[model samples]
Target: MGLIITFLAAAFLIAGVVRGSFVNKRANEELPFPTPVSQEVEGSTDDRDVPYYDDDKEEDEVIETITPFIPTPTVSDSQTSDSSATNAYIYPNSTVLSTTANSIELSSTSDPGDITNWYKKLFEEKHFKARSFAQTNTNGHVLNKLAGAGGSLDLEVEIEKKPNEKITVIKVTY
Candidate 1:
């Protein structure tokens, strides 16, 4: 039994030494050798022989042929005239409350209902208050009305004209 064990140990040691020597010799080659070409490269033809950019000029010509069209915004006098007419109707009896491209200010002796009634009569759509109306007594009149009771009574309404150039309706709650 002792002899068999000793023989097996000697065999393993010899195998290990052989493997280590083989690896070391392979890793320590002295030649500064060039890398071997892969099989794909060895069998390939010259790339320049075929036209790689054959479609490049054609592609540029195609792009040039496509002229980009940018449409300009045309403001018709009729539209402006219509907008002014609508504006005039919105604050017929009221004082020049405030006026801007996007907003209007009016001071009137009438109640909030009167203001709403005017809007309802002029525009097909309903206009509601965006925020509480702030109450101010400018010459004995409520300046702006918020949408509902206890909301601001003084109103600064934001009016937006839709892309179709039609007026968008807003309601004030006060």
Candidate 2:
């Protein structure tokens, strides 16, 4: 009786295991398979039917066909002509050694007795002839009567003359 009971219990356990495995297999096989949509089908269904464009478009499509990257040549200051017709004059003995946008450099062979005389000649030559000399120092001289009589009389001077060789470097600003 004991042997029969044990055999019956073992058979019942095997039957339950077999039934559970069969049901699991059937459920796996009957599962609804997901359908894969092709690229063409997905694109056609989209609201924007046009194909997606990457950065790999043709040269013509990627760049503007009409206008290309054209480099423009630059014009230099030497090539441009002076627009103003007004002319300036330098004394026959005097020559403009160099010039800049802000100042004019002049050299002369005349004897500048003192800073006062040197400043006077410089002022007169620069169209400040109507003005009078004001003061003088070891460095430079000043003009008392302004060129624009009532306005400002701003001047700066630098001398680079050797005793034997007569030359002067006068810098003026107004």
Candidate 3:
């Protein structure tokens, strides 16, 4: 009886291994799992709820369609029609990015320290009180004066030079 019981146990273990192998083989031959399918709901008129795909779309074209921001150069300081239009003098070698009624943005390749010193002297000569500050990557100045319109006007100039970059951004606000 002990021998018969031991043989039956061995036969059962062998049968389990064979069955498991068969199941694994079938799993590999077929899809391991069912894929999710999108279903449309009845009476849904909103097209946004549906998914649309264009098979011809290429990712390369999407990258090519992007436009870069290019700075637009303004008239040179000497070529400015009216000095009053811009109360503060623009850097001679700077490229103007944009201009508004009370502010101007520019890009330059000059050293930040040189630009700050130039502005300080220019403002002082014009009889405006100026204060300047400097740091590792940036320098700026603030000029104050009694406005002809009976109020005080302050001009702020900031220059930033990022590490490993050739372009310096300058912003002037009045």
Find the candidate with the highest lDDT and give its number: 3
Q: Over the stretch 32-85, how does candidate 1's per-residue lDDT look in tens digits?
A: 334333233335565333223232222212222567999999997644535654
Kindly provide the TM-score of model 3 when superposed on the true structure, using C-alpha atoms: 0.42
Please identify model 3 stretches exceeding 4 Å from their true place: 1-88, 130-134, 138-151
Candidate 1 vs candidate 3, lDDT winner: 3
Whole-model lDDT, candidate 2?
0.49
Model 2 is weakest, by summed lDDT over 10 consecutive residues, at: 142-151
TM-score of each: 0.27, 0.31, 0.42
Q: Which ten residues in a row have the lowest lDDT in candidate 1?
A: 55-64
RMSD of 2: 26.4
How many pairs in model 3 have backbone atoms within 3 A of each other, for residues 3 or more apart or on separate chains, i.e. clashes? 0
Candidate 3 lDDT over 1-174, as tens digits, reads 999999999999999999999999967763323334445657877644454454444333232255889999888865554646474568777998998767788888987777877767665766665454544532333222211111254667777776677888888776
TM-score of 2: 0.31
Clashing pairs counted in every model: 29, 0, 0
Clashing pairs in 3: none
Which candidate should be chosen as best, given TM-score against the real structure?
3
